[model samples]
Structures are given as C-alpha cells and as structure tokens.
Target: MKRPNFIVIMTDQQRWDHLGCYGNPVLRTPNIDAIAAAGQRLDRFYVANPICQPNRACLATGQLSTVNGCRQNGIPLSPGQVTYAEVLRAAGWRTALIGKAHFQNVTDVPAPSRQAAGKGDDLPASVALARREQRDGPDYLNEVRAAWAANPDRTVPLPYYGFEYLRLCIGHGDQVEGHYSRWLRDRCPEAVDLRGPDHALDDPAVRVAQCWQTALPEDCYPTAYVAEEAEAYLRSCRADEPFLLVLSFPDPHHPFTPPGRYWDLYDPAEVELPASFGDAVNRRNDLPDALRQAYRMGDEDPHSYWPFHLFEPELRRIIALNYGAITMVDDAVGRVMRTLSEVGLDDDTVVCFTSDHGDYMGDHGTVLKMGLHYQSVIRVPFLWRDTAQRRQPGVSRVQASAIDFAPTILQRAGLRVPVGMQGEDIFAAPPDRPVLIEDPGIGVFRDPDSRSALISLVHDDWRLSLLEGCMDWGELYDLGADPNETTNLWFDPEVAGRKTELLLRLAERQLALRDLSLCPTARA
Candidate 1:
C-alpha cells in the first residue's frame, strides 16, 4: 500500500458543539458533518492549552506547552523544537502549510517583561529590546502584520516550523494580512478597503458586539483564499510521493465579520441563548472572585483580547455571525475535498479536522477564551477519515488531546514516532489516561493581589481545575451530570474524596508527562 498522504483542516476558536454532527441544531456544517459521518468523530477531544499558539505548538510538536515552551498566545514555537512535519519532510514526505500558520507571534509588540530581581544584571532598554528580537530566528517576525506592511515583498522562509511551502493568513476575520492579503490585493484591490467595522455594510438590525457585515465578497475572503490555495497545492502534488498539507482557517474568531452572503445566512433573532448563559447559580456559586466581579459589574474593557461577559442580545448576534463564519469555512472545506477527489488523492489521503482551541460562544455568558476550563473553550471537534483502513470508522467517546495529533498523523503515515514526543498514537487503541491541560499566568482579573495560573485534569466523568492564586477557590464539574458545567463541586463534602483522588491523578499525570524527549547516554 502507498504511504498515505495527510490533510489537516483546522479552524480557529470553534467549539465542539458548534458543528452539525456535534449536536449543534442550527449551524449548517454539512461538509464537516459529512467527514464525521464517513469516519471517526472524537466526541471528547480536548486541547493541551486553551489558547491558539500554545495548543497549536502542542499539535505541531506532539508535546505539551510546558515541554515545548509555547505556554501562551504571544510566545512562538521555538525554531529549535522538532515538529512532526519536519520529521515527515526529512523522511521524503512533502509538507506544506496554507492559511494561518501562526507558529510565531503575530504582532510586533513584546509581551510584559519579567525581569529577575538583580540590579547588576539589568541592561539598557534598547539593548534589551534588540536582544529579545534576536532570541528567535531573523524570520521570526514573518507573521507580524506591521513587518509585512513595512516590507510587502516579505514571505515566510522555507521549512518554517517544518512546513516547506507556506501561504500564511496573519490576524483574524476580514482584517487579515499576509499571503492572503497579497492575493486579495491582486484579485480585487477595492476589497482591501472594504475590510473592518469602519467600512462594513450597515446592518443596524444586528446587535452583536464586535460584529459587522463585511462588504468583501465571499470569494475574496480568507476562507476562499485558503481553499483555492489548498486545491492548487493538491493538484501540484506528485502521486507517488506522500505529502502533508495543513489547511488552517483563521475565521470564526473575534471581531466577527463574515463577508457577502454569509453575513445574512443566519438571523440573530432566531438564535437561542446557550443553556448556561447568565445562569445566576454558576455566577454566584461557581465563579472565582475575578469572574464573579466581572459578571456582576460587567467588563470595563469589553473590546480587549481577554474573555468578557456579553449581554444576551450581543451574544445572540455573535453566535449568528460566528455560525456564518463557520458555514463559510465548511463550504471551503467542501471545495477542497472535491478538489482532492478530482485529483484522485482522496483514497490515499488521511484527512483530519479539528481546532486549535474553542471560544466560549456565550457559554456562561462569556464571549471569548482564556484561562477558563469550561467545556466550550477547551473541548473542540475532531474528525478523522483514514481512507487507508488504518483506523475504524465510528464515533469515539474516548478522550483525546491535541498532543496526540502529531503522533496519530505520523503513525498513520508509517513513520516512526520520534523520541520525546509525549503523545500516543490515537488510532492504535483507546488511551485510558487523564488529559492534562496547563495554562500559566492566567490570573484573576482586577484583583491586584491575585496572580493565578490554571492547571486542569480531565478524567473519566469529572473535570478538575486548580487556580493557583485564588486561595482555595477551585472548580470541580461532574461532566456526566452537568455537561454545561454549571455547578461547582469543588467544596462539596460528598465529592471531597473524589476531588482528592482527582488531584492526585492530576499530579500523577503531570509527573508522567515530564520531558523525556532526550535521554542522557553518559553519566557525568
């Protein structure tokens, strides 16, 4: 049998429940649903971290964010770290990443400085900035829009984080820049001016927060650009040589702007509120102090990147617009899949669909994602269609993590899973292991004294989260009972022993996940 090709389709900030196959009643994702029907759907797939860069890095390296060192959104996947793509590429497999290869920081701005308390080690600000810039490769800023704006001719250097050919979509929504931006400019220069809320088609009826109807035609959108590029790449592939093509869509994220006809595809008035939306019980009993305060007083900076509470009207419109974006992506997927079949590669290709992470999508009245361990944010849709007959085709209730992605792909391609990769081959068998999710430095907001980091453990039927700086305030949800995660059983006397056992399990899992990528051959 021929070594199977790989096609990974990933979406940004999409919840597991937002797809047609995943129990979403309203959203029309027939293309994605078809994939699920034809193959295996991972019902309980979770991300290693509930952030874009960190979880994506985890998928690339098959290592946790803690091990790979991409612990947050701004942090880039270090060039030195080995990616599964790099391994496959080295082993005579072609690798290409199209659309939103966010392996590096998308913005030119640096993260908050954390200096050690030592007067002698302090350096001048300019020198410090220069040194920081030199930390990553010279092409580190390839994804930054400002850098691209300054140099229009700039393109991602070959073999970026293991992908040989690249077509990057930097930033989100209609306001994206990078290769897609260049393509859009070439196709329709006027479409560029039509992006953003400032020039959005007036939709006074829509009351979604940070949502607008983009005037850019659906064909000119980033989703279309990704599908077109992917189809072209598929047509360019050699039948004999195996290849890994990753199609990452940057849509269905913040500042919702589905273009053209997709804008009016769903009516906000008809959209129903999430079951847990504005639940007074969870707000009062389950929320940590910071979140409780935010829920009560409302977010001061609603437009900021951090997760915030949203009103019912705003959430309804947001959900409708988000569905529009998702539907557009689904259409794009259908286009690419048709191209794959047309090119006669469908039978030989191992196709997988998932997301880097998920958005709150109005779960618990929240609009975005962050440190929260809510199912809406951490759990994502994962569908695998292995036409090679390597894996069984059925809905799997087995819990899988993003870390398993690389290993699964490698194993399916008949490649050796490299040393130091912490992920198991998901297709091999059901892994009866607790999924460990680590989010560092996600503290309680507005509370100056509280500096929290989140570490969660998801086992059979329970999800446990330990917030480091919020005193004894932790979250324990019985997922079997309450899938919406409305009730907190952390301090409950009845589940006290269970909580202790789960905590012990979390500690054991952490210990088990320790870095073993490299083993010492010689004793010092």
Candidate 2:
C-alpha cells in the first residue's frame, strides 16, 4: 500500500474558541470547520509552551520544549537535534515546509543553547526573558537578503531546520520579510507597504498594533501567500510519492491587520469581553499576589497592546479585529483544502490544523500572549482529519499537545516511530494523559521575585502552574469548577490538600515527561 501523505496546517496565536467548530458562534470558518467535522477534534488540546518557537520545536522533534533545546523565542533548536521530518524522511516520506517556521534561531550565525531549551537552571528569569545574548545577533532581513544574494534559489532556507524544501516566511503582519516578502513584492508590490500606518485606521484612540484594515489588497495577504504556496506544493507532488507538508500561517497573531473585506467581516460592537476580564475575573481572584503584581502596571499601560490605555470597549474592538483575522485564515484554509482535492491527494492525506499556542485575545484583559498558563494562552485547537480513521465525528476530551504531533503523523503514514519520541499515538492516545506545558518566560515576570521558568500541567480537570523556585506562589486552578480559570487556588487553605496531591502528581508526571529512554530494556 502506498504510504499516506501528511499536512499539518498551523496558525500563530489562534485560540481554540476562535473557530466555528470549536463552539464559536459568530466566526464562520467553514473550511476548518468542515475538516473537524470529517474526523475527531481533541477538545482539551494544548501546547507545551504558550509562545511560538518552543512549541514549534516540540512539534518538530516530538519532545518537550525543555528537552528539545529550543524552549524560548530566542533559542534555536540545536543543529544536532533530529526532527521528525528527518525521521519521517528516513521512513520513506518526502517532506517540505512552506511558511513561517520558528525552528531555527533565524540568525545568520546560529546560537546553540548551551543547555536544553528551558533546562537552564543557572539562567535568571530576567536573563532568560531578556535574551541579552541575542541583542546583536544578525538582523534577520539583512541575513536572509545577503544569503539569497549569495545563494540564489536555495532549495531550503537555512537548511530549513529539518525540512527538505522550504518557502520560509518571516516577520508577521505588514512587516513581512524573507521569501514571503519577495513573493508579496512579485504579486502586489504595494502590499509590501501595507494599508498604511496604524494611524490610518482613523481612530485617534486606536493603537498601531490594534485592529485595522490594511490598504494592501486581500489577495496579497500572508494568509493568501501560504495557501497559494501549499497548493503549489500539493500540485507539484509526484503521483505516487507520499509527502509531509507543514504550512505554518503567521496571522491572527498581532499588528491586527486584516486585509480588505475581511476587515469589515465583524463589527466592533458585536465583540464581547471575556467573562474573566477586569472586575469579573478579579471578584473571585485566585491570581497569586505575585502574578497580580506583574499585571499591575499601576496607572501605566501594559505593553501587551499598543496605546496601552485599553478600556473594555477598545479591547472589544481588538477582539473584533482578531475575529476578522481568523476569518481571513479560514478563507486561506478553504483554498488549500479545495486544492488538495483538485490535486487528487485529499483522500490519502492526513491533515491536522492547530496553532503554536493560543493568544490572550482580550481574555483576562490582555491582547496577545505572555507566559500566563490561562486557557486563553496555553489551550490551542487540535483537529485530526485522517482518511484512514472511520470513527464517528465528534469531539474527544483527551488531553493532547504538540509533543504527540509527530508520532501521530508518523503513525498515520504507517511509518515506524523513533524510540526516542516522547508522545503517544493519536489512534491510541491516552485520554487521561497529563499534558505538560512549559513557558520559558520572555524577560521579567510580573513580580521581581518570581521565577522565569514556568512548568504547567493539565491533568484531568485541574491545571497547575509550578514556578521554577517559588513554589508557594505558583498557580493552581480548579478548571473543572472554573473552566474560565478565573481563580487561582495555590494558597487557598481549602485546597491545600488538593494542592499537595497535585504537587505529587506533577512530580510523577515530570518524571514521565523527562524520561529520555530511547529503547526498551533488553535482558539477556
């Protein structure tokens, strides 16, 4: 039998609640919604890290961010790291990456993490977050430009981490660069400039990074670029050759610039504030004093959003823009799905759509993301559309993460999984698996005393966040009772026993997650 083809469509900073299939009432994501309707959607899906590079690294290597060695945004996956692409290729799969890949450190001269991604004990939280070492690292645009000038038509950009072919796109929003920049220039040179400055949005109160419609034509948006490239790759695939393609989209992220009519898709008045934001979340506040202090800008605006003086109404507008961006992505997804059928590869392909992580998106009054372990930032959408699996279409409450992504894909392709892979097969995925989430915070916690390295565990109905040394101040949420995660129960006397039990559970879970056993024990 011919091995199955694979496609993993990933978006940046998209929340699980943003999709129509995910119980989102307002957003119309027909293509993605249909994909979920075809197979099983894991409802409790999450990422090991709430940020980009780390979890993307996990998906690439099938290991936790701490273990894979790219735990934070600035750190690059080690060159010695054996990504699943390499394994799948060795297992007789042709692979290509076509879009944003934060796998490499994105530097001309790569910086190897001395320790694995989030395993740096000697590093201070500020140091880890600040990325002081990368201050003078080669500018990404100049490096990509010079590299392309020197080596025209380089098959894979910077060896593409592990992909055999890459049409790499870097930068997000109107600030697009790399191969995508060139592609946009070719199609819509003016798109390279965008609708204009955020000030052009005409709302004096609107921040540059807040919701806005760009002057650039919708056809030339990055979402369109990725969709076109994915179809091109699908069309180019040989008739009998099996392939693995990762088309990562960098949108619904920030600089909330949706192109053309998508900008008008949602009205700001229709946007609703999350129940956990402001007084609502604070009324039953379980946020650690330290976490609260971190969020306390004290009359100053948090840099999470532009203009920073965000009121409830302004946040709603931002949410509306975020919805628009999701719609735009949905349209791109529709085009790619149509092309998959057009190329006659739809039936044999195993397609999964997810995101690097979820965005705050006005949840808890934040815009994008921080190291927070709230469902808004850590919980992402995971859908598997496998032609081989003929199960009743529905949502599975199984806890899933990017760690399982590679093994799941390889399993669908009928390829042997590497013994070193630390994820379960999706076909037999553990419904009660304790999903581990890691966040190597980007510089300075809300409280100066807090640890920068955060480890969160989503086991069953409880989500616990363990601070790297400050154990007492860590967060524990009874997600069963407060699914919105409005209350932090870390120091609550009522749950002291529960917290202790969870601590022990976390200890055991950590051992399981940290185990690097590459082979079964052989007794002679």
Q: Indicate the worst ten consecutive residues by lDDT in candidate 1.
A: 441-450
Tens digits of per-residue lDDT, candidate 2, 186-227, equal 787555345445424456454534445577777887788889
lDDT of each: 0.83, 0.73
Full-model lDDT, candidate 2: 0.73
Per-model TM-score versus the true fold? 0.93, 0.85
Clashes of each: 2, 7
Where does model 1 exceed 4 Å of error?
A: 118-134, 203-207, 281-298, 388-391, 441-450
Residue 200, candidate 1: Cα error in Å is: 0.8
Residue 345 alpha-carbon offset, candidate 1, angstroms: 0.9
User: RMSDs, each prediction?
Assistant: 2.9, 5.3
Cα shift from native, residue 457, model 1 (Å): 0.4
Instruction: Give candidate 2's TM-score.
Output: 0.85
